[model samples]
Target: MKKFIPLSILLATLGATNAQADFQGTPTTNAPSWVTSWDVTVPCPVYVSENQADNIFFEGGFDYQDARKTVDGALGYRHLMSDNKVMLGANVLYSHEFPRNHQRISYGAEIRTSVFEINSNYYHRLTDWKLTGVDQNEEKARGGYDVELALAVPYVPSAHFRVKHFCWNGIASNIPTNPIDDLKGNTFSVSGSVYDGLSVEVGYIDYTSGNADYSKAGGERFLKVSYNFDIFGTHVNKATKPRFSNTPYEFERMDDRRFEKIRFEQKVISANKTDRDA
Candidate 1:
């Protein structure tokens, strides 16, 4: 039953949204974006045919993230298209941080072809306080989004350059509002993978938040190394066929370039500080 307990917890998160690592209103300038992502899928019957196949997969995994250590889980679905040269999928993620007791959820979808793919995610913060300390639940950057386009260079199979845009959907509060386009960010990165569930990424990231003006535009260098335990894609290119390696597991990966919304917290805090001082 030891295994059942963990499996149950993982399944429970399926009703959840996507996931992310923890933050105390600060940006870990170096960590990639997956730091803020996850997806969940409800189980459904599977069908396989010569031209098409679809499956419901359950997965769970761990992350010793740079910002905070966290546990994440998810369920997802995928379908092959165009003779398996193209694919479409969607997922929801749920994550909980061990340190600050932060919780996060997200949802996203993607379409991948032999040559390129596009994916997008919507993120929501679940919890923002320390269970053992003061209830400083002043979390504001609750809802945000990111969309990415990755182009594969056939020569290397795993080599690709991605363009991603992150937009802070203002702050989440009882008061309704709209996203301020000025509070947005972007990343340009090159990624490649090696054998045995490993990959690497290096990129330039730039963004603007509340306290930070878009005009004063800034950029930073980002790098990451990721590894996974794959029942499949262990010998093949996980980058080219990520589903084979990632599906049927319990956790949605924390993509290294997916964390720009961290900047929006500063925007929210800056506004609050101004009101207090005034």
Candidate 2:
């Protein structure tokens, strides 16, 4: 459960960006030649404990984007607490954007309880790109950190209501100043289990960001639908097996067949001894 935060935050941010585009209105003349964007993600495995049992898990996934022709990957590990009420984990992510000829690397930690989760991560820019000007020699990269909080509530056996908040702060280098300022956003989502190892989700996002030049605020509406594959079956399979009683009477009842076999063997030995005596 803790390992899910990083991936969720990434997807939420991506969805928020799309929502912003819709709210800001489409550009008629300045629209890019390639306007539509699409993304696909695959989770190799998602191990969930059965019956709320305590356990550890590792998960990884790959992602592709059509707009930038970019590919990315993420990996994480999580450990459930002995009480089965909490979880802790960490994750690392990397992405390559071919259009901008740049890359991004990030890592973070997460903590989760029965109904809530908190995740914080730091991102590093690995490119020499100027945000303010086109001078290649004066280019400088930017980095930032983001924190996310998520909540879940069960509406039915297979349905849940989810909400999340995201906050981010950007830092700039000495040369080109950072165009983005502090950003804060919230998202509301509904998710439901479609099958044993599959589920579907839809969400909406709204946010405000402080800009360096204009110091303005804006909001966006976005939607996301996702399908999940679980290779290790479902949560029911991971439950702890029940333990049997060890009392003497119960043991005797359980071993009745063995006791009968022992008695028959003793009788056969006694009969053999009587024949020898005769």
Candidate 3:
């Protein structure tokens, strides 16, 4: 009598090997350093005042490449205080890139309290940067902060997958509103378009106060356009077809008969060889 292997055992082994071949989707989060990004929006209860003015405003940026552009996606949560008149919120954003000779990941967090009843703009970018000069690579580590107030609605509301529109009209002033110097100004901006990951804004700004001076040469409006794709980053080629053709059902039966003949011949040959050696 001869021992035999179970079909279940063969299937279990094959399943383990196939599990390793599952595909993972490409990354679409990282972005270049020159890009300035923000996930800002105005929720309900405090509708934007600009919509009544018949003007629009917008600002946004995005870049994706075949794992080359990097990824900076975020998850944010907000809580309504005083029935949406006040909001206490926290946001987390991160970006990563794993490419040849360069592996970098950056993240940031923010906790803000705002009173929509009083137009306000409070945003800060917390990153330590090393600025390297041309002659000798220089790097400076520092964090930047921006806090301003507007006479109009402080939050602008817009959405993806919709016709983009945004506008902001407010008297903006720096941290210290007193003496107001060159730090105070009135700004009005308008923009409209769709979200293909690019945005532009144009506005008029004027400022005048004791120890303050600012000007926009006949309404400051500048054009900005940026696009990114992912070829420089990584090799992501894969084959979908199997390397060897599978045995047909009928051919499998033929294989079994052929295998039995080979087994008998091998046993006879082994016995002959043993006798000859003896």
Candidate 4:
């Protein structure tokens, strides 16, 4: 819209920088090519049967992420099992992370078969997670979880294969501070699909494990652009093919690993970069 206000003032005049430690981030909001980073899906309406699992649908997703200012909202439900190839899903999530503004709630589940897909997610951090901004809260435990495995090969359905595992500051509440849990992360990406909604991805995130510290190494490359929707016309994957957390590049790669726990829990790493890890 109006070229997103001069690319949001050139990404707020380039905020975080340190060349992004190799996890790839180099000022990008996709130019006058603005969509201002979005992820939206709406699919509600059902009734058409032959007992192919009755095929029900209900979807909703709202996300805004331009490198780090992430905002998310989602509500979902999908089903198509009855021996018709299987498909199941559930979602409920809310996120707000920006410059360490922390706020979170998450839950996800999935199951698919047509070419295999499995996803699981859990992130919790309702406040207090600042890294350079303050508030440690003992690394604010009790938040982090991810596991995804995807593949869609077999005549090139659109090309896909994803593998992900991440854990950032987990389990340990009731007030404490400083564990950071090494902020584990692992990623792999490959996606290509263009026609129905939109998708494009390229992945790599393993900045030498945990606390990303790479000056210019061999790891750190991630890029993605995703969009999803099916509002009033409702099609719902036509039967199956959108599980991995709303598949549109795996929901921005598991919502950008919850903003990489404030972008790699900084040790001096910041820059207007993008390749997918907020």
Candidate 5:
């Protein structure tokens, strides 16, 4: 009963929290002409040009620990293709210890379609519990892998210019250990925001595994909530025709030597300013 209680409580809390996080505004194309879709997950790096690369996201949050508080941090990257119809990215998360005191790294990729998106994630948990000649209480749980496949669809896209809804289904499991494997399961998620760059996600998970007969009845469920921040990329169209104007700052690549001279003059001006300030 005690074992079941901890899992039950965790699912309830995170699930409830994620529901609130899913409340975001409608999708907008104004973000960037190159952006394919709204970034609902961690970012992944994809290079589009010699100088144009994808943006990555960094995240942190708080949780409970040995009768106190703890913190968790994550980082990820995302990229959009030229057609602006496909998106891809990856992310990793690590949380401090509560009872076991360990760190976990999770990374995966996501592909987006017009109607839905598919996600494949892999994670491993690492802990320092014991050593060959160390203290008995110094044992550790090294590394393990978890794989989850999820399918999500945007239902309403955006409602009242305020809320957005999405539904997902798939399976998740610990591939390394059969004890924590989940054979069948599904997840429900929603997201929205009060303003740009500020949003939330609410998720509920229901899963069943081979050990369900010996495990708790009703399978298992969890709730999660999260906020996201965005970093944008800068890109230029090198293949396009050039347009020049007779302005102090207006010039074309045809006059590269002339611009080089201008750049030298600007450097001299900047150096003079530094000297005067000094």
Candidate 6:
């Protein structure tokens, strides 16, 4: 019988791997580098603010292809650094792939600043399957880690470029007789905001396996668009004045009138006291 490891133990082990490192934010929550072009890619969809405290966000998206389809969602939280220049946070993500019927769960931490972001994640396969010609069912417990970096363009406020490297060390459960036991890959991409809440991105990925006799290298590409906004109806006003309140001059006049009434009442009370004494 194949032994199964407890999920708690797995999580603990992953967490300890980077316990001593200083906190750094991820480009995006729980996203693998090969799958996204920017640190904050769309479709993986959670937004954490760098200036807001206790920010919580939820995002979901769908991706389609000729024979594969994917749907994913994320919930995340962020706390601003004391200086307001950095944000630290964590996220929990879930995704399901159709046709093949596989699912993934990821947990990770990230650090984000005005100029760049750093993110790390640990991914777990929740279900296991066997490919054709494989005699036995493969391991249900497989996962990996990825570290990503994103840099902002000095001239373009909305544009950011990113790179990532990752490693996966497990049996190849999805491909039959694939001589790969461990794989390492790198990804590169660029992303930019087109409008207030809309963004566009493009990325490329290449990877190689440890198998010396059958080493393989291939490239993957993607183009995507994503939008970010407050789900609770809290809209940010860009105007200098209050968008839904009275004008500043009107407010000042109201304050002045209240102060005048207070002064008149004080004078009347003082005259009454003096008359009683006399």
Best by lDDT: 1
- TM-score of every candidate: 0.61, 0.52, 0.27, 0.26, 0.42, 0.57
Q: Encode model 4's per-residue lDDT on 1-278: one tens digit a residue.
A: 11112323433333222223322222233232221243444545444356434444434444444455555555555556544455566666666655555567777777765465777877766764345333322122236677878787444445566787765553332344422223456667666555455666555555434432322332344355555564465443332233333233321112111110110111112222111122
4 against 6, candidate with superior TM-score: 6
**lDDT by residue (tens digit), candidate 2, 54-76:** 23333333323333345556665
Can you tell me which runs of candidate 3 are displaced by over 4 Å?
1-71, 81-88, 95-133, 148-199, 203-278
Top TM-score model: 1
**Ten contiguous residues minimizing lDDT sum, candidate 2:** 262-271
User: Each candidate's lDDT (Cα)?
Assistant: 0.46, 0.40, 0.22, 0.45, 0.31, 0.45
| Runs in model 2 lying further than 4 Å from the true structure | 1-19, 22-66, 130-142, 157-163, 167-180, 195-200, 212-217, 231-278
Better of 1 and 3 by lDDT: 1
Error of 1 at 71 (Å): 2.0
Q: Which is better, 2 or 3, measured by TM-score?
A: 2
TM-score result, candidate 3: 0.27
- Candidate 4 local Cα displacement, residue 44, angstroms: 22
What's the residue-level lDDT of 119 in candidate 3?
A: 21
Q: After superposition, how far is residue 164 of candidate 1 from its true place, in Å?
A: 0.5
The stretch of ten residues in a row with the least summed lDDT in candidate 1 is 260-269
Residue range 1-278, candidate 1, lDDT tens digits: 11112323533433242222122233334444343322211222233344335644544555554444556665566676555555677777776655555667778787765457688877776654233333432333345778899876434445567889886554433323422232466767776655435666656555544323432424444455555544432222333333222222222222211110111111111111111112
Model 5 is weakest, by summed lDDT over 10 consecutive residues, at: 262-271
Predicted candidate 6 versus true structure: per-residue lDDT over 44-101, tens digit per residue: 2234344345566654555544234666666766666545555676777776766555
C-alpha RMSD by candidate, in order: 13.5, 24.7, 32.3, 17.2, 21.1, 26.2
